[model samples]
Target: MFAAAAIAIIITMVLALIRGFIGPTLYDRILAVNMFGTQTVLVIAILGFMMGRPDFLDIALVYALINFVGVIALLKYFKYGSLSIGPGEERNTEKSSHMDKS
Candidate 1:
């Protein structure tokens, strides 16, 4: 039933939170956080169905888009010092500069 599915999603979210907290590396934590966000979307959808509210799906879609964008931003932040681009050739130069700085 939908209730059972919702319970399973909650359990998965809890596990994801634990992994995010105790992850050995930054990437591991990022992945766990992303998983948690995905699980949350599922929970929202399930709750929407249970409550007979169609708006929950709309909220879930917005959350999913936000989650996707957030993860991409985080990954870019980790890889590049800044989100601003420095042109085509400068992009490579910037990467090399970043590496040299590290």
Candidate 2:
């Protein structure tokens, strides 16, 4: 049963990769990539169980965290054209307005 689950996850991962590559819109691609990351985590956990090494779950957890952060960064970067989200970072609206005058 566990082996079957792993295989299913792998198949879904492949489909997600395909969608990520060929999706029409940016949002579609982003969602596909996110799905792919999730499926990868599932596959990793299943593999660990099959191999009698549950320690891989820790690695999977780290990978999932990375995936979440990476997706957020990508969305923010694309939406704002910048990746800096620090508390002290301010938008240069004045600079943009000044440029518009010229």
Which number leads on TM-score?
Answer: 2
- C-alpha local distance difference test of each model: 0.86, 0.86
- Give residue 27's error in model 2 in angstroms: 0.9
Q: In candidate 2, what are the lDDT values of residues 1-102, reduced to their tens digit?
A: 998898888889888889888999999899998998899888889999999999999999999999999899989877666787533454556587557658
lDDT of 1 by residue, 17-67 (tens): 999999999998999989988998998899999999968999998999999
Error of 1 at 20 (Å): 0.7
Score residue 13 of candidate 2 by CA lDDT.
88
TM-score of each: 0.80, 0.81
Off by over 4 Å in 1: 86-102
Please list the residue runs of candidate 2 whose C-alpha ends up more than 4 Å from where it truly belongs after superposition: 85-102
Q: Per-residue lDDT for 30 in model 1?
A: 97
